[model samples]
Target: MGKADPKESYALGTAGRGLDPRAERSRAAALAAASDLLIENGWAGVTHASVAARSGVGRTTLYRHWPEAAMLIQQLLAELFQVEPVERTGELRADLIGELRSFLRVLHNPKSERALRVIIDQAPLDPRYAEVLSACSCKGTDGLREIVDEAKARGGLPKELDTDVAIDHLLGPLVFRRLISGQEFPDQYVPELVDSFLEPLTP
Candidate 1:
């Protein structure tokens, strides 16, 4: 499918200073372009020049914000999943379900899912991309760990629950189905999945 053109923005001159609204629009366009390239052509396609051409931002501006493609990829992944932590309601099951639903939504987004697949597929080829993937994975792990910690403190979860293993249990299957089988996790499955994971650990 043909992608839409990037929005028009005021070009920042060499002497431009202060909060240039155009700069924000340019950055947005660059990110959209980079993500599209990632999904369409994989990691090798997301260079500064390619992004600049697609985004209509100058090379100088793209380079000024993102020195490397890896950095740009990192930002792309980060922005796609900028979901806030689910509110803790002192109920472990409900809280976990809330977070799971949010995560599922992000993963199920077509662009985000495609971008993630590209990153994983290219990680073996480029050490820089491997690092970016690791960083993004760590962010997800940390968020899951926080939820586990909160649940434990609330006196419902098992103290022995290994947060790392628990996180893997929660996310691994969803990721497998999304990336490998290319099937969406039905919305009705959220509570079932959450219950299954919690049943083994919740006392």
Candidate 2:
């Protein structure tokens, strides 16, 4: 048999300029356009047609990939929230502190914060958006679960503490403080939060 061209091997999917550059560029453009629209008009202003126009991709292509703006925005947030793997660091306090700091940074962004609020506010009226927002939140909670589990393993927390409740205890106050106070949380509060939560759990 004749040796098949190497290009032929990759041609089945994205090979031959069909798969790599064009697809990636289109996806990036869509995300960029969606982000701009989100920041400018909030979630209400993003539509599949608008995104396609702004992204310079065909409306058909956009529809083929993401049928709705909510899905597209969900995808955009998923990309934005991507972070390095959580570090165990062999010290529960350090690990919790690091994760919380990162979380606060993400939640504190004005545009991102506003975007999330819009999704949440619209949830009751739009069930589809609720589902999307719920999925995004669950992804974030999974990250929190990792930190809590690590703390349990390192003997920094009580053996019997329920992880879900423990996570609530740790994070609930910080979120409430942010939303209610409408002020930036001081860096000193992070250690205080860690110390307060850890103190009650330690043997």
Candidate 3:
């Protein structure tokens, strides 16, 4: 990946004015185009021009909103995951399970899963994809850290482990099962995962 830093402020259109209805529609169309392009031609195809051509959004408008292919990639990810920053409830086990399910919903979606897979596989060659991947990963990591930190502040997670370690213990199996084992985790997966991680740390 060239590390093509769209270096995008990622705040092109809305420095001050939030997107109007018309602008929002145009951005949505472009994003839809990006999604289709990603699935059809992979990450390499989702340029501002390609999205404009597919979405019929003017280049000026596309540029005004998504200045680079990386922006399109980021937006496509936001669309696919719809994985909003799930509000924290301060309940460690429940919070962890909720976060996993938020991600699981995306994995269960065939198109979203395929798009994610494509981005990860192509990241080495497409710097744009890697940047988006790093950005998205950071967001998730932050959320997980928040959950663990809150639990620790409440005097939970008494064991000698940091938030990141706890997260690895909680998510490692899921990753291994999904990516390495080529398997779909069953209903028991999340609860069992939470229990295993929490049990060792609990007094």
Highest TM-score model number: 2
lDDT of each: 0.71, 0.68, 0.70
Return whichever of 1 and 3 wins on lDDT: 1
Model 3, TM vs. native: 0.71
Q: What is the TM-score of each candidate against the true structure?
A: 0.74, 0.75, 0.71
The parts of candidate 1 lying over 4 Å away from their true place are 1-25, 60-68
Q: Best-fitting candidate, measured by lDDT?
A: 1
lDDT of 2 at 114: 56
User: Which runs in model 2 stand beyond 4 Å of their true positions?
Assistant: 1-20, 110-115, 123-128
Cα lDDT tens digits for candidate 2, 49-131 = 88988889888877755666666766665444433456667677887887777667657776556556666777788765576
How much is 114 displaced in model 3, in angstroms?
Answer: 4.1
Q: What TM-score quantifies how close candidate 1 is to the native fold?
A: 0.74
Runs in model 3 deviating more than 4 A are 1-25, 47-53, 58-71, 85-90, 110-115
Error of 2 at 59 (Å): 2.8
lDDT of 3: 0.70
Cand. 1 Cα-lDDT: 0.71
Cα RMSD (angstroms) for every candidate in the order listed: 7.7, 6.8, 5.3
